[model samples]
Structures are given as structure tokens and as C-alpha cells.
Target: MRPFEFHRPTSLDEALALLARPDARALAGGTTLVDLMKLGVEAPGLVVDIGRLPLAGITLESGSLRIGALARNSAVARDSVVLSQFPALSEALLSGASGQIRNAASMGGNLMQRTRCAYFRSHDWPCNKRVPGSGCPAREGANAHHAVLGTSDHCIAVSPSDVAVALLALDASVAIAGPRGVRHVAIADFYRLPGDTPVIETVVQPGELIVHLDVPATALATRSGYLKLRGRASYEFASASVAAAVKLEGGVVAEVAVAIGGLGTVPWRDRGAERLLIGEALGDAAVDRFCDALLAPARPTPDNRYKLDLARGAVHHMLARSRPC
Candidate 1:
């Protein structure tokens, strides 16, 4: 790791000021940041330790679950309110790393975690996400783990956050604090597609700090669930994962939200495709049509073409499992 100045800020304002510098990076749990620093993928001049800030609270208010950014993944996953009201969110958190990692990974850090694309993590490979305009060897190289749904010529790296997918499905919002003031960004708009500038992955500015996330309490969230499929069971990123919530009325779909991870540059959600299932019974035909519409925009490379099938099956299974009998 590179030599850097460390500052343990005692307040949010102090942390914000420390992070205002372009070459500074925040350390919450250091689960992802420390690994990236060790791999030489990240070398910030200043490491601002924001873990001491008073941003680690999980509360429910006005029918919305407010999760402080510094809340540990394990705490959130095991919270009674989260397990009862937003089980999908809890499940997604548990499906992530291991018990130890979940204990240390913060909610904000999980959202800020970088992609696990081999090319981007390695300096030896020319990756557009790592170095803009350099080239994306994953576009033609070993890309079985790369994305298919939100791929651009510049980058095909998948978004690797399981909790983000669940949050997207639950219609969550992120609160950010910056030099100007605080602002809330909808989960759908939080992530950016890997366009020409793949390095600019999220809407977060250099100086901004994610303060917390808000997930509205809804019937759909109560019925939600998450399913992750990977080569191994634990401590592995998803090859294809689904987070879905469905509400049924009169034996037909009344409300639904679906999001997929490990298959897109961002947590992929298609409200248009979801509209196809409204007012229809979630039968095989309806499920097939929804899946078809959802995956229609996918542009899978030769090596990762199987992800299309995996995602299709995952969507079908998750929707079925979440539907009320």
C-alpha cells in the first residue's frame, strides 16, 4: 500500500471536509478499500477514517426503514425490523461475503465497492474502468464473469453489490452529505451505466459521503426475497442474482419490483418489463413473457452467453417464490 496521511474524523463535517480533497478516500469498515489498496488498485493520498462518525444507526420512522451508512452488514441483516419487513434486504446482505466480512462491511461501503472484474483489479491488464481510454480486454478476453445487460464497448464489468439489488427492488433512496448540503438520490439513479467513462461508476461526487439509506415500508417489501446463484455457495460473488417483491390482488399481480445484479453495470431493473405482469396471474405464460421482455435488451458476449439463461431462470424462480399463494 502507498504511504498516506490518515485522519479519524470525530464529526460528519470534519469527515466531509477531509473527503473534499480529490485525492482523499473514506474508510468506513475498510473491507473493500483495504483490499483495493493492497492490490494497488487504489492509492489515495489521504485516508479519512469515517468509522468514528455518528452514522451507525438503524431505525424505523414514518413507514420507512432508515439505515445509517456505517451500519454493519451483519447488524442490518440480523435486525428484527429488517428481517421481518424487508426480508429480501436481509437475505441479500447475508448472501454476500462471510460472517466475518458481513460484520465489518458497512452499508455505504457495500454500495461503494468496486467491481470484481479481473481486468479492472489488475494493473497488468488494460481496462477502461481502471484507466479510461486504455482499452477493455475483458470485452474479448476471459469475460465469463463480466456483465451482459448493461455492456458498452468501453466496459462490461458487472456491478457486484447484492444489497444494492435488493435496495433497488425495494425502491430505496440514498442520502448523501457534501460541501454544499445533503441530498437524497433514488436507488435507481444512484448507479451509472459503464459508458465511455467507465471509471465514473456512480453519481457520488468526490467530496460526498453517503449518510444513510431509506427503504419505504410496503406490502411488496414484506413479500420480497433474494436468490443468488454462483459457482460456490459462500464467499463468492453472484454469477446471476435476483431480488424480487410481488403483491397479489384477486389472484393477479397488483404490484411488483425486480432487480438483477452480477449481470449489469448497475443493479438492473426494468419497470417497463414489470408492467407486462400487472393485472395478470403470475402463471408460466406471464412469467415467460416478463422474463422475455426483461432480458430482451441483454447483449451477452460469447463466453458469458450462458448468463442469459441463468438470469432468465433466476427471474422466473424469484418471482414465483415471492408471489403470494
Candidate 2:
């Protein structure tokens, strides 16, 4: 890793001040940031250590589950409130990484982590996400793991975050702390689609820090589950996954929220699927329509077209898990 100045700030104000510097980055868990530095993919002049800035807590407050950004992934997964109230989210956290990495990875850092696409990590290949206008080689070469939805000619890298899939299903909001003050952005609006400039992955400004994740309580939140399908049984990234929450009334689906990962540029959410499920039972006909609407926008390449079938199976499987026995 390149030698860089590091400042451990005790206060949020001080941390923000340090982050205001040119080419400065925040060090939360050091899981993702440190790896990028060693790969020469990222070289920040200064790293503002916000690990001690008083932002690590998980609470179920006022009909919502509020989680501090610095909360450890393992801690959140094991928290009583999280396990009871947002089990899908807990499952998502536990399913990602190994036990050791989860112990060190922070919640905010999970979202801030870059794509796992090999081209973006290696300096030899040209990637628009890493270097704007360099050309996206993954589009035509070695794209077995590339994205299908919200993908453009510039980039097709997926945001590898299982927690993000769960959060999107729960309709969570992210609280960002900036120079102007704090602003709450819906999880749907937080991640940016790779339209032309793939370099900008999020709506967060350079100096902005993600402070908290606020998830509202709903009937669906209590009855939700996460299913991840990977190459191996353990410690592997999902090839296809589903985070689903549903509310059933009189044996009919009242509401359903679903988001898929590992197949889209961002955590994929399809309101059309939810609309098709409402007021109807998840029978063969309804499920067929749900799958059709869910994968309607998917533009899979030749190598990764299998994800369409995998994603469909995941969605159907997770939705079944949510049904009360």
C-alpha cells in the first residue's frame, strides 16, 4: 500500500473536516478500503479514521430498526432485535464473507465497497468504472459474472452487497452526514445506475459519510427471508440471490417486496413483481407473471444468461420461505 497520512478523529465534525480534504477517504472497517489500496486501484492522500466516531449501535426504535453505520456486520447479524425483527437482514449479513471478515466489516463499509469484478480490480484491463472512458472489456470478454439490469455500454459490474438486497426489500433509508448537515435518502435512490459515468457509484458527495440505516417496521418485515445461491456451500459470493418480504391476509398475498442481487448492477428491486402479487395467491399463474415482470428488464449477455433461471428460482424459493406454515 502507498504511504498515506491517517487521522483518527474522535468527533464527527472533526472527521468531516478531515474528509473535506482533496482525495481523502474514510476508513470504517478497513476491509474494502485497504484491499483497494494494495491493488493500486485506489490511492487516497489522506484517510479519515471514523472507526471511533460514535456510530456503532443497533436499535429497534419507534416502529423502525435504526442501525448505526459503524456497526459490525457480525454484531448486527447476531443482535437479538435484528434477528427477531429483521431476520432477512440478519441472514443476509451472516451469509456474506467468512466469520472473521464479518467481525471486522462495518455496515456502512459494506455498501461503500467497490465491485468484485476482476477487470476493475486488475490494473492491466481497461474499465470505465475504474478509469472513465477506458472502455468496458467485461461487456464482451470474461463477463460470466457481469450485470444484466441497469447496465450500460460503459459498465456491467455488480455491487456485491447481500445486505443491500435485504435493505432494498425492506425499503430502508440511508442517513448521510455532510457539510450542509444530515439528509435521509431512500435506499432506492442511494445507489446510482451506471448510465454513462460509471465512476460515480452513489449519490454521496466526496466528503459525505453514511451515518445510519433506518428501516421501518411493517407486517412484511416480520415475515421475510433471504436466500443466496453461490458456487460453494460457504464463504462465496452469490451467483444469484433473493431477499423477499411478504404479508398474507386470508391466505392471499397483501403486500410483497423483493430485491435480487448478483445479477444486477445494483441491488435489483421490481415493483412490477410486487404489484402482480398483491391481492393474489402465489400460485402457478401468479408466479409465472411475477417471474416474467421481474426479469423483463434483464439484458443478460451470452455467458451469464443462466442467471435468469437462477434468479427466478431464488425469488420463488425465498417467497415460499416467507409463507407461514
Candidate 3:
């Protein structure tokens, strides 16, 4: 790791001032940041610790759930209301990392975690995301875990956040504070696809602090679950995952929200699939159609062709299991 100075700011203003500097980065849970630093993927001159700020509480409003950015992953996952109402979010959080990591990983840090692309991590490889215009190694290199959608000629790395996927399905919005003052960004718009600049994973302005995420109140969101298919049962990343939130009224689907993970540069949302089941019964054919629509436009590489079928199976499984909800 490179030598760097650290400052644990007690107030939001102090942290914001430090972050305004060119080479300073916020340090949240440090679960993702520390790993990237060790791999030499990120080397900021100053680590402005924002974990000390008073941004670690969860509030249940009249309708929505307001989650502080610094709220621990375990805290949110274990909340009775979250577990009962937002099972998908709980499942996603429980499916990631480990118990210790879940305890240490904050809500904001998990959303801001870096990609898991090998070429991006290996300094020996030529990656444009690592070094601008250096060229991409994953294009013709080992890419079993790379993205299948929203990829660009410059990069094909996928966002590695299960929680973000769940939040996308829930139609959440993030509150951000920057030099320009506080603003809100829809969670879907918060993450950016790898177009020309793969290095910039999010739409967040520079020096912006993620204050909190607002999970909207919806019957669909309350009846959701996340399903992940990995190589192992624990401590593993998703090979393909599906997040589904469905609300049924009078034995028919009333509303649905679908987002996919482990297969895209950003949390993949399928509006067509969501529409297929919105006003119909979620039968096997409806489920299959939903699955097909979700994977129809998928563009997978030779190394990860199985991800398409894996994603299909995951979608089917999640829908089938969610029926009793």
C-alpha cells in the first residue's frame, strides 16, 4: 500500500472540506477501500474518515425507510421491519462477504465498492480504467466474471454490489452533499454504465458525500427477495443473481420491479419483463416470458456464455420461490 495521511473528521463540514481537495477520498467502512488500496487499485493522498460522522442511524418513517449512509450492513439486514418487509434487501446483504465484513461494511461503502475485474486489479495488465487510454485487457483476456451488458469498448467490468441491486429493485434514491449543497439522485441513475469513461462508475459529482438512501414505500418492495447463484455457498461473489419484488392483489400481479446483478456493468433493470407480469398472474409461462425478456438482449462473451442461462434460472427460481409472498 502506498503511504498516505489519514484524518478522522468528527463533523460533516470537516469531512466535506477535506474531500474538496483533489487527492482526498472518503473512508467509510474501509472493507472495499482497504482491499483496493492493498491491490494498488486506489491510492489517494488523503483518507478522510467519514465513519465518525453522525450518519449511522435507521429511521422508519410513515411509509419509507430512511437508511443512513454510514449504517452498518448487519444493522439494516437484522432490522425486524427490513427482514419482514424488504426480504430482498435482507437476503442480498446476508449473501455478501461474511459476518465480520457485514458488520464492518457500511451501506454507502457497499454501494461504492469497486469492480472485481481481474485486469483492473492486476497492475501488470493494460486496463484503460486503471490508466486512461492504456487499452483493455479483458476484451481478449480472462473474462469469466466480466459484464454482459452496458459494456463499452473501453471497459466491461460489472458493479459488484448485491445491496445496490436490491435497492435498484426498490426504487431507492440517494441523498448527496457536495460543494453545491445537498441533492437527491435516483438509485437507478446513481450508477453509470461503462461508456467512454469506465473509471467513473457513478454519476456522483466529485467531492460528493453520500448522506443516506431513501427506500420508498411500496407493496412490491415489501414483498421482495434476492437470489444469488455462486460457485460456493459462502464468501463468494455471484455468478448470476436476480432481485424480484412483486405485489399481488386479488390473486393477480399488481406491480413488479426487477433488477439483475452479476451480469452487467450496472444494476440491470428490465422494464419489459416487469411489464409482462404487472397485470397478469405469475404462472409458469409468465415466469418464463419474464425470464426470456430479461435475458433476451444479453450480450455475453465466449468465456461467460453460461451466465445467460444461469441468469435465466436464477430469475425463474426467485419468481417461483416468491409466489407464496
What are the Cα lDDT values of the candidates? Answer: 0.93, 0.91, 0.87
lDDT of residue 10 for candidate 2? 90
Using lDDT as the measure, which candidate wins? 1
Model 1 misses residue 277 by how many Å?
0.3
Candidate 2 lDDT tens digits, 1-325: 8889989999998888888887999998899999999999999999888999889988887999999999999999999988888889999999999999999999999998999999999999999988999999999999888898899989999889999999999999999998999999999999999999999999988778999999998877878889999899788888999999888888889889999999999999989768989998877678778989988989899999999999988887877764667
Worst 10 residues of 1 by lDDT: 316-325
> Tens digit of lDDT per residue, candidate 3, span 1-325?
8899999998887888888877888888899888889999899999998987999988879799999999999999999988888888999999999999999999999988888888888898988888989998898888898888888899988889999999999999999988888899999999988778888888766678999989987778778999999999999888898888777778778888888999998999988778889877878899888878887767789998889889888887777765755
Each model's TM-score, in the order given?
Answer: 0.98, 0.98, 0.96
Off by over 4 Å in 2: 322-325
- The worst-scoring run of ten residues by lDDT in candidate 3 lies at 316-325
* Rank by TM-score (best first): 1, 2, 3
Q: List pairs with backbone clashes in candidate 3.
A: none
Give the runs in model 1 whose Cα sits over 4 Å from its true position: 322-325
C-alpha lDDT of residue 235 in model 3: 92
lDDT digits (tens) for residues 222-300 of candidate 1: 9999999999998999999999988888889999999998889899999999999999998989989998998898999
